[model samples]
Structures are given as C-alpha cells and as structure tokens.
Target: MNRLRTILFATFFYILSVPIVMSVPVSALFGRRAVIRHAHVWARMHRLLYRYIMGVRVRVEGQVPAGTYFFAAKHQAMFETLELQLLLGDPAMVIKRELSRIPFWGWAAMRYGGIIADREASAGALRSMMRAAKALKAEGRSILIYPEGTRVAPGEQPPLQSGFAGLYRALALPVVPVALDTGLVWPKHGPKRPGVVTIRIGETIPPGLPREAIEARVHDAINVLDRERRDYRMVQAPPAA
Candidate 1:
C-alpha cells in the first residue's frame, strides 16, 4: 500500500512539475518577483501532494522569524528542501553545484535565488559561496542551508560541514537552527511512510561568535529531535541572550 502511494505520488509530482518548470523562463520575463511567485506555487503544490496523497503532514513548532535570517536545518531527506522554501517564504537556498547544473531545474533555481556551492572545500568555492550569499543578503532575502551538507539516517548526527561556519561568519546574520524527524518517514532510499514530520525551530543564535561556539550550538540545536541522541527527546532552549 505504501509502495503504491509512493508511486502515485511520484508520478503526479513529476507530471505537475513539468509545466511549472517550463514556465520559469516565462516567469523571468515578468521579473524576479514573478519567478519567486511561481516557485512558491510549486512548493505549495508539493505540500498539498504530501498531505493528501502521501499522507505526510508537517507540524512546525516555534514561529519562523520575520526579516533576513540564516536558517540552518538538518538534512535527513529531500522533504525539507522543498518544504522550507514554502515555509520560509522563498529564502535564498544554498544548494549544491551539481543541483545547479541540472538543465532547466538548475536555471530555475538560479533564477529563483539559489546560492550554488561546490561540495569540495576549496578556498575558491568558499569565496564564491560567500559572494552569492552576500548578494542575496543585500537584497533582503533570508538564506536556508543544510549545514550537514548531506542527508543522514534518523539516528545519525554528523558534524557540520566547514562551509556552514564560513557562510555563517561571512553572512553575520542570526542563525535559526531547525531540527526535524523527516528521515523517520522519508527514507533516503525507498518509499516514504505516512507520518507527521515535526520541524522545531530553535532559538536564534547571535552572529560573530567564534567558529567552535557557533558550530557547537548549531549542532546541538539541530539534533534536538534526534531520538537516538543521548537526550532522547526534543529540547527547546530559551532564546539566546
């Protein structure tokens, strides 16, 4: 039954994605706002499919802050990647360079304000990412980045990529750590299960702290929902002073 639902969901999602993806170029004619409007529509449609067809629902704890913020989220599955765009009102997403090369989708991502970062930890790549992030910040757009750099199983909590710290320091924006249990339902490989994925927004950490301090805070905050962790439950800390 789950397999059937997955198949149906994927089929319809792909079918629905075509026209929207193609329309991105057309949206560009109307300017960036039109492109973002179309992107938001695309994200909302995916959410609807998740709720009605996949039987997956999202429960967000804590309000998403207003204005520009550095959103650092856990990467457990593909679910949050699209969901965050809608939830955060279309922030500039930090996506991999590979994703930015995918023909039309890549073109749309760039057009819609995605920051492309190479996975390799080279100085040049870091510089390039900072430049893009700064550009978006100047435009009054928030940024969403998966600090772990890749998805992991529900129980695993890997150290954040160096790029995360680099971008954090470069952007100097308050960081909102987002924790979730999406991997429990949306496995990296295989059909997704129907369940409520809880997204817990942690307190905003101020910018300009040392690399280690910021990284540690973000690591713990983003792992609050990891049941396999020592805490074994969600821990919502008070807002940072």
Candidate 2:
C-alpha cells in the first residue's frame, strides 16, 4: 500500500515539478504563496508517511518558543526538517549553497524564502544570513537553522558550524532547541522501517545565555535526545501553537 502511495505521490510531484523546474528565467513569475503552499503540501504528505506508513510517532513535550525564535535543531535525520515544516509551518529556512543550484526546485526555494549560504565565506556569509534572517522575520516567519550544517551518520557528531553563535547573537531572538531521534527508523532513505520516532520540544533558553553557553546547552540537549535514555521533560519549550 505504501509503495503504491509513494509512486502515486512521486508521479504527482514530477508532473507538477518538471515545468516549474525547466522553465526559462524560472524566477520571472514564481508566486510566493504558491511556493509556500506547495512546500507545505509536500511536508504534510511526508508527515503522514512518517506516522501511518512508517509506524513512527512524534511526541513534543515542551512549548514552542514564541515571537520569532531562532530555531536551532540537531540534524541527524531528514526527519527534523520535515517535522519542522509540518509543525512550525513553513518558516523561512536558511539552507546551504548546493540547494540553490538544483534547477527549478532550488530556484523556487530561494525565491520563496530559503537563504542559501556559501559555507566557505565566513564574513560574507554572515552578512547574507543577517539579511536573510531579517527579511524572513519581517515577513512574520521564524528561522530554522541546523547548527551542524549537514546530517552526520548515526553515532557520529558533526562538528559545530562556526556562525550559529554569531547568528543567534545578531538575531537576539529566543533560541529553541529541538531534538529528534528519527535516524533509527528513517535511516536517510530507501525503504523505511517501522520504529518509534521521538522528538522532544525543548524549552527556550533566554538570550542572556552567552553564545558559547547557548551552543553548549543546545548541543547537550540534542545529545541527550540522541541517547533516548528516558522520557524526561523537555526544557524551555515554546507554547504549543
């Protein structure tokens, strides 16, 4: 049943996607509402897949941080990305440069809201982020950031990216730490297995937590979620929206 559903969904995606991707001067008429609507539809479909098809369930324990938070989530599985999309709605995402080159899809992401950053350009990238961050917030959207940049293989911790602290400080918004242990089931792609998916909605650490302190705390929170030790209360949660 899932296979049939997957194929049907795939067909629908490409049928609508090819023209958008292949069109010349793609950005010429990309409507903001269309991109936002389409992306969330994809997310909602995946969310259903994660729950019913994959036999995975997400449990959020804390409140969602309020008033334009700087959402820093640990990226062990692609699940975090989709869950955020489903749960938080489509807040403007800050993505990497590679996404910008993916023909039609990439162009759509950028035109709508995705901020593609050149990881190598430290100062310049920071400048771009500040601009992107500001623009997104102004649009009444939140910033979704993956501090580790890319998903590390299970049991491996990706080194922290250098600019999160700077970005957090600059944004001066409440930082919400989100932790999910979805890698065990999802395993990055191909056929997914049925497993318990757990996500802990952590508390908002006030901005006064120094950048290093904030980084350390959130990283530790994620590591603890990685452990999946016990179902403890998630700290500093944003109110359930």
lDDT of 2 by residue, 62-173 (tens): 7675567878777777677767876765778878889888866787678668876678957888888888888888888878888888886556666567767877877777
What are the runs in model 2 whose C-alpha is more than 4 Å off?
A: 1-31, 230-241
Top candidate (lDDT): 1
Q: Pick the candidate with the highest TM-score.
A: 1
Worst 10 residues of 2 by lDDT: 228-237
Q: Candidate 1 versus the native: TM-score?
A: 0.94
- Backbone clashes, each candidate: 0, 11
Q: What does candidate 2 score on TM?
A: 0.79
In candidate 1, which residue ranges exceed 4 Å CA deviation? Answer: 227-241
